[model samples]
Target: MNQGAPNRVVAAQLNIPRGTVGWWRSEDRKVRGEAYEQPTDCPQCTGREFDDVAYAYLLGLYLGDGHIISKRSQHHLSIFCNATQIGLISMAEEAMRKVMPLPTVTRRHKPGCVEVKSYTKHWCCMFPQHGPGKKHERKIALESWQQAIVDAHPWEFVRGLVHSDGCRITNWTIRLVGGERKRYGYPRYFFTNVSSDIRDLYTDTLDKLGVEWTHCTRHGNPYNISVARKASVALMDAHVGPKY
Candidate 1:
């Protein structure tokens, strides 16, 4: 009996006659195929091709917090970002739509972050820097066309990188001007990563944007580049604003 022990099964074990108890099983019960139909699995993605801004953003996102998982015919590209970075999620989904149009991607909540993943067959072709271990341990070099894309739309690329692995925060410190002490607060961007190559790509883009950044890392801190000068921060604000 489905619910532990139904009356019919109990009666049968007790030697009660089927017709006497009126609990015999029905002969009209349907067989497996007759009663249910098999459901088809959904396709991962259909769209193909690429865009300079979108692909550059995706590349940056991949270099930061994204990775690919491949199956026989379906390879998934997933990027993780803070939930507050809804704008980045939008950009990522839009990029996925442009690059791999068929199967759609979705944003899922994961603890303090959100994950966006889509099934595609062209992930490896897009991210040639992908390899067996952590990105820091692997050599990451962009192709000529990939470099051209980043050069053309460096802001979107930096935005993707910042949203995934960097952050924008208010940094305040007290400075002594003559005799008076004053508190100064400013918005600064910090991009921290393990791979020097990835960090170099970020710095190169910042250089093209005319934003100055310095390598800043102390104990327990990751390798980072910080853009904190007022003019440089303003330049970055104009080009790539903070993630939502």
Candidate 2:
């Protein structure tokens, strides 16, 4: 019955009465505390093909600043974006839909941000990293399958992480060149997260991409990764430009 076979069919296969099969199935469901769960197109659960690029990006977002709620009654995957960044919000929603189109996606406006959410319990299956406490307080590591996806689409994953908790900024300095004071601007990218594991993931991907970066300390805490090399900045500009 769980495999979508009718009670009569299952009973015939098991050589049992249809009524007995139905009763046993009902009891099993009751014991499992499972209601009639809607069928899901989750790639993990259904073994269906999904948008790998979108999944990689969404995975980065999930590890950076997004989260999943898997309560019995309320289940959703949410990625919060600054209210001012309408493009980022739209991209986040698009990524969610591309990965799993069946679930309904919605946005909730908060004080200074918008929460892009997809309603479904299957998100927990998609993102097994979802846990009970703060991400930085626990061990956060990618599964083998997820790492494969990230390796295949490293730029998209980096873009997603940057869009969530990273930024591109420019700093300038004045110098005397040919007796004239000129200002030169340096553009760099920074990914700041309290999770050391997440920072490692970001740096590991950067290493694969040949992007040079360094650890930055803020307020005496080394939770920031900076990409300031000229070549690295150019690479980032080409692939993961500033989040709009």
Candidate 3:
């Protein structure tokens, strides 16, 4: 109903909405306020335009034959399907629609051999190309990748690296605080990776916080010895556990 946006068209033959047909755009309330455009290509001909088909087929193959996505295959999928315009689910669905339709044709093969073939032949119609086991393999690999990164200090390291990679943080030797004998024996040392402009601010902050510090070289590095303890294996391990 919004101006300058695509309107819903009721196809007489199909009795269905043809404007961005069979997509979440129809279900979302936000689409009413935004602009819409007519699709240049047919949904059946376009890439992964239909999750109802592509993801469903992949899930079917995964459940029925235990196909898994692989690292190499995932990489390939990412390379080709990275952009939102050409995502894996949409591209895959397009591939499936070209090769296998709702009512697909099948043929039997010799014992122990998969005689998978497609009637709707095209560059994309390569269903059952990756064995059903591939999906399961990919699932396991993803789980392992996730688990390997879980509870790892490298995540914090990576996060800080990313955050301070280009952005300027206060550059100054901030004092480090050592816990009292009654408290946990946490190390104390100076930290000096702060930006030069905010060095005074950082210094004042540490001074007010009652932290101790001493000067050392390597001011730009995060491991500068301006804090409570010297940067060492023992000290690093206390914050981030011993590397396995």
Best by TM-score: 2
lDDT of each: 0.77, 0.92, 0.32
Better of 2 and 3 by TM-score: 2
- Best by the lDDT measure: 2
Clash count for candidate 2 is 0
Q: Say which prediction, candidate 1 or candidate 2, comes out ahead on TM-score.
A: 2
Candidate 2 scores a C-alpha RMSD against the true structure in Å of 8.0
Candidate with more favorable, higher TM-score: 1 or 3: 1
lDDT by residue for model 2 over 57-163, one digit each (tens)? 99988888799998979999999999999899999999999999888799999999999999899999999888999999999999999999999999999999998
TM-score on alpha carbons, each prediction: 0.75, 0.85, 0.19
TM-score, predicted candidate 1 vs. hidden true structure:
0.75
True lDDT of residue 136, candidate 3: 24
Please give the lDDT score at residue 119 for candidate 1. 68
- Cα lDDT tens digits, model 1, 1-244, are 2233433455678788645433233322243223321121222122334566788888889999999877675677899877877888888888877765544478889998889997654677677777788899988989887898888888888988887888889988999999899998999999999899999999998888888999898685659899999999998788777888
Clashes of each: 6, 0, 28
Q: After superposition, how far is residue 181 of candidate 1 from its true place, in Å?
A: 2.8
Tell me the lDDT of model 1 at 222: 52
Q: What is the C-alpha RMSD of each candidate to the true structure, in Å?
A: 12.6, 8.0, 21.0
Q: Candidate 2: where are CA atoms >4 Å away?
A: 1-35
- Ranked candidates (TM-score, high to low): 2, 1, 3
